[model samples]
Target: MSAIYDRVALIGLGLIAGSMAHAIREGGLAREVVGYARSAETRETAREINLCDRIVDSAAEAVADADLVVLAVPVGAMAAVAADIAPHLKPGATVTDVGSVKQSVIDAVAPHIPQGIHFVPGHPLAGTEHSGPRAGFASLFRNRWWLLTPLPDTDPAAVDRLTDLVRAMGAKTDRMEPAHHDLVLAVTSHAPHLIAFTMVGVADHLRRVTDEEVVQYSAAGFRDFTRIAASDPTMWRDVFLHNKDATLDILGRFTEELFVLQRAIRMGDGQQLFDYFTRTRAIRRGII
Candidate 1:
């Protein structure tokens, strides 16, 4: 594939950004890839590993003269990064983010985007339990859904160019409304993660279950929960905080469902349990 942008700046040189750098390089989607991380040690690691063509010292420097700038930072820090890079971005540059929550990212990043730049909020529904710079792989986004929530007035050409770039990186691109994106993610990702964390915490607090027993006798279900719970703490924290409304709404529905399940179990309503499980099984099958 030909280069979609002459220079692409990746702000936050973590798993997503590092994976992007590899993908862009492997696919020749960008002529030059530059990256910046807030942590000095992270920048050093990025340099040692050749994560990008250039490892810059600051977000402003990384974005300078770049045709595309990607804010791959935590949702809570998007605004600060945006503010830092806005003045340094080249005219007509397109800025996009890989934040999980779209509405909050839009609210935080849109205000700082320069007049000529495009601020497209996006979420790539792909990741592993692992994180950090070393955890990135070139094929991480293959066949994954990368959804963009561009504002109504956003330039069509800019959006199309970004779609091309993401496609070249092996992701299927789709567009969605920011709020709807948040709600969808809440159901698909946020609620499940919260539940996993809660389950792990519950097991830890159980008096009868020792810590060693919990680790040694873990079944597949609890093991999966542990994997989900092991995701980056800071990133998940920011996700829950920024996406509170949608997540809470989903959690409320989840609580109601749990209550129904509990009542059925207490009453020995085998038919009700069977029917509910059958319905949920169909949904899982559909996902597969």
Candidate 2:
């Protein structure tokens, strides 16, 4: 165990922030963790949970003298958080974020970062449907992918420092351009979450009409969608609102493919349906 940073400031006290606190404490990655949240209730809860060495009232107050600052807020709040912490961050301190969408986060936070500080936009491809400080577990990052989208002029030493911190938290690290990261995640995570939310909504409506029969006999497939759809509404809402373009692009492609399958089913085109099933099955096995 090694202390990578003398002090680490966390800008939000949600699941991701709590997990980071736990991970850093368990691994001795930071000498101290200072945290801030918008709601007084959340800050109080974070203190009760003992997630940080210190909990403060404002973002500016938290980042003072911290060697590394992690903005674990929603993607939509990146710029505002960056603005709040900019003046307080010590020179040469590293700043990063745990946002789902990378491009928008980079766009929002990059301009607000001061010249002497390092801004390394990152996304940990991990989390459960749960939200709030209570939902976090120390092992959430184990075996997860932590993606870093560093700017071209980013200092190599700072990049390596963040990468080491990520690995210390039990996540393996990867790198990509911010735009590519957003596009890939739009198809993999964002689109699936949207589809799950829609399906759950549709099922609930159908259940209302049919008197709850759908829930009574739900199979594994629909049940899984329900679990995913049960995710925190505020987080998902922020994700969709901030990553609109990529999400809509993927949704358009999904709709087009869905229409083709619908036509095959309507026409009783057995061979086309069989081929589609086989192809999808192969893809599924490939994932394994």
Candidate 3:
């Protein structure tokens, strides 16, 4: 595909940013991909890997003259990054993000956007447990859903341009309402990550299960839990904190369901346990 944007700046050099750089290059989505990270070490690593056409020292420098800027930092860090880059952004530049939660990120970022710039908050529902520059690959977004939550006054032409680049990188694009996006993610991603973390923590606290035994015997459910629990801690912390209301709401419902299951097991209700598993199994199959 032809370059959708003359230049695109990625404001953070983590997995998502790294992956975007690769995809943009592979798909020819942009003529230039300039990357910047808060850490000198990360910038150096990205340079070493040749992750972007240009690895600039400052977020401002990375975004200078770029047609599109991507905020790829944690949700908690969005406000500061937005404030830092607001002054340097090119007029008419379309700004987007790869944050998991939408409403909080938009709230943190939108006000800093200048009059001429378009803020299109987005989330790519794709990742692995691993992080950092080296963890990214070009195909990471292939067939993945990339969601955009644009504000009412956002420029439609800018949104379409960004959508074209995203689709060129092999992702399917869809638009969502910011608050509703947060609730949906809380159900599909936030609560599940919390549960996996909790389950792994419980296993660690179980004195009877030695570390070696846990690791060796973890070829089953516990193994999958560890994979989820092993995700970037900082990112997950920010997600949970920023998406507080929705995450808490989902967790509350999960607790109610857990209580019902616990009662059934305690009362030896074999039929209830079987029925519950059967229903959940169908959901899993449907996803497959």
Candidate 4:
């Protein structure tokens, strides 16, 4: 706790914040961990669980004189959170975020960054289909890629310090351009989540036609999609709303590909299907 910043303020207390607290405490990365939540119930839960050393009622008070501040709120609320805490942020303090959509978060937060302070927008490519403080674990970020999209004028020293802190939490760091990060994540995480949501919805519809016992007989394959589909609606709504362009772009491509498969299946073109399967297999191997 004595090795890194003197005090670290967390602006939200959801899964990402809870994971950061545990990781920081486990690695002794900060001298003090202070947290703030929007709701009284969440603040009380955080205190009862000992998620942070101090649970302040206000965002500004929580960040006062803190060396580092992390905004862990939903993407849609990022700008408001940034505006609320900007005035109270200590001079030269490093501020970062754990939002999924990089470009939108950058747009929301960059304007609120005060002079002499560093804004290094970061996203840890790790999480479960769970939300709230109680669902987090210390090893959530371990072996995950932490993407840092630092502004051009950001101090190199501040970026390095935040990178070191992320590394100490058992994650690797990579510097990425914000737009590129959003595009890549839309393909990997956002699209998959949307597909999972669709698949679960399809199943739910089937329950009306195929009977309510359909899920009772669902195998592991469909069960997995249901689990992912059960993710927090508020968080995902913010993600899609904030990163609409990238998600729509990827979804359009996905539908185009689906039409190609549908054509092959309808025409009984076995060769076309075989070739598509072979190429997709190669891509899967490449991913592995």
Candidate 5:
């Protein structure tokens, strides 16, 4: 594909931004990609690996005259970063984010985006247990969902341009309302990550009581839980904090369902247990 933007700026050197840089360059989606990170070490590492066409010193410098600016920072820092770069963004540039939660991101970022510069909030439903610049690959978004949650008043041309870039990077693009996006992600990602973290914490406690047998006798179930639990802590912290209401809502539902399964187990209600497991097994198969 040809270049989607004359210059693209990445505001963080983490997994998502790094992957975007790689995908954009490999697919010829942008003429130039500049990146910035808060950490000096991260910037140095990105430079060593040639993660971006240029590694800049500040958020303000990174977005200078850029056509597309990707806010890949933690949700909690979105507002600050938006403010820092708002003054430097090009007149007709588009600003987007890779935040997992959309509504809160819009709440934090939209007000800072200057007039004429578009802000189309987006979240790519793709990642790995690993993070950082070195963990990125050009094919990370291949065949994955890249959801955009543009405000109703956003420019249609800007949204279409972003959709074109995402599709060119080998992702499937879909637009949704911001609030609905948060709720869906809460059910699909946030609640599950919390559950995984809790399960791993419980296993850590059990290991103390059982003389580390939990680790020694680990199975696929526990391993998978740990893998999910191993996601970047700072990112997860911001996700739960920004999307609190929806995450709590899903957790309440999960707890109610857990009580039902717990009762079935305690009573040895074989029929109920079988039916529940069968239904859930179908969900797993459906996902595949």
Candidate 6:
């Protein structure tokens, strides 16, 4: 791996950004990596851990003369961060984001980008339930998918450069239309997370089940639900709010499937239950 950018600025020193810092350093993908976070404590932690070559006090300072600027903040904060850094961006610099909800983030940040800069929206399909500056590792993105939803008018050279950098950092890159990406993510990520949160909440609400028993007896299935539910609430809330329509569409389909399963259980339709499970099991096998 060699240097792809002279300088890369990362805004928000959380899990994704921190992991990127580690990966960039490990791969030598950027000559200089600088970062910023809104929280003073987060900045202190980043400094303590040497998360980046330089940790700046402001987003503006972090992005000064940067060749690549990555907005790694929450989806809801994209616009504000974009506005703050827009005026400071170098003329030929490329700006990209790690927001899960592509359309809303583009709507928020695109208007703030200056004329000569490139704005490419992206989402990396990789992470653990863990977060914060200390929770990242260089291999977090290894063999994981990094989807970019660049606008049709975006510069091909800029997109190619970004793809090179991500690939060097151990991710497989793919490009898609923004709206289609949102819908795909809704089925693959968002709705599943919502179901996990709901299942965990149901366990909490069940009076007949003691909390101790639920904790002690949680099988692998329920434990996986808890892991998904443990994702950052602020990030998940913004994701759901921004991606409402796609998520709702997927959730509606999921509800219909759930109702069918419920009816099968109630009516003792063993054939229907077995066939449904068999088909779904095949899908899991495909994923594996």
The TM-score values for the models, in the order shown, are 0.97, 0.97, 0.97, 0.97, 0.96, 0.98
Q: Assess the local accuracy of residue 227 in candidate 2 as a C-alpha lDDT between 0 and 100.
A: 84
C-alpha local distance difference test of each model: 0.93, 0.91, 0.93, 0.92, 0.93, 0.95
Give a tens-digit lDDT track for model 4, residues 1-288.
456888999988999999999999887899899999999999999999999989999999999999999999999999999999999999989999999999989998999989988999999999998889787789999999999999898899999999999998999999999999999999999999999999888877773556356568878987888888999999999999988999999999999999999999999999999999999999999999
**Can you write out model 6's per-residue Cα lDDT over 72-144, one digit (the tens) per residue?**
9999999999999999999999999999999999999999999999998899999989889998899998999
Which pairs in model 5 have colliding backbones? none
Residue-wise lDDT of candidate 3 within 109-188, one digit each (tens)? 99899999999999999999999988889999899999999999889998998888888888999999999999999999
Tens digit per residue, CA lDDT, model 2, 1-288: 989999999988888988999999889999999999999999999989888999999888899999999999888888998998898889999999999988888888999999999999899999888888777778999999999999999998999999999999999999999999989999999999999999888877773456367666788988889889989887889899988999999999999999999999999999998999999999999999
**Could you list the CA RMSD of all candidates, in the order they appear?**
1.1, 1.3, 1.1, 1.4, 1.4, 1.0
By TM-score: ranked, best first: 6, 1, 3, 2, 4, 5
Worst 10 residues of 1 by lDDT: 128-137
lDDT of 1 by residue, 185-207 (tens): 99999999999999999999999
lDDT tens string, model 5, 47-108? 99999999999999999999999999999999999999999999999999999999989998
Q: Predict model 3's lDDT versus the native.
A: 0.93
Better of 2 and 5 by TM-score: 2
Greater-TM-score candidate between 3 and 5? 3
Off by over 4 Å in 5: 207-212, 285-288
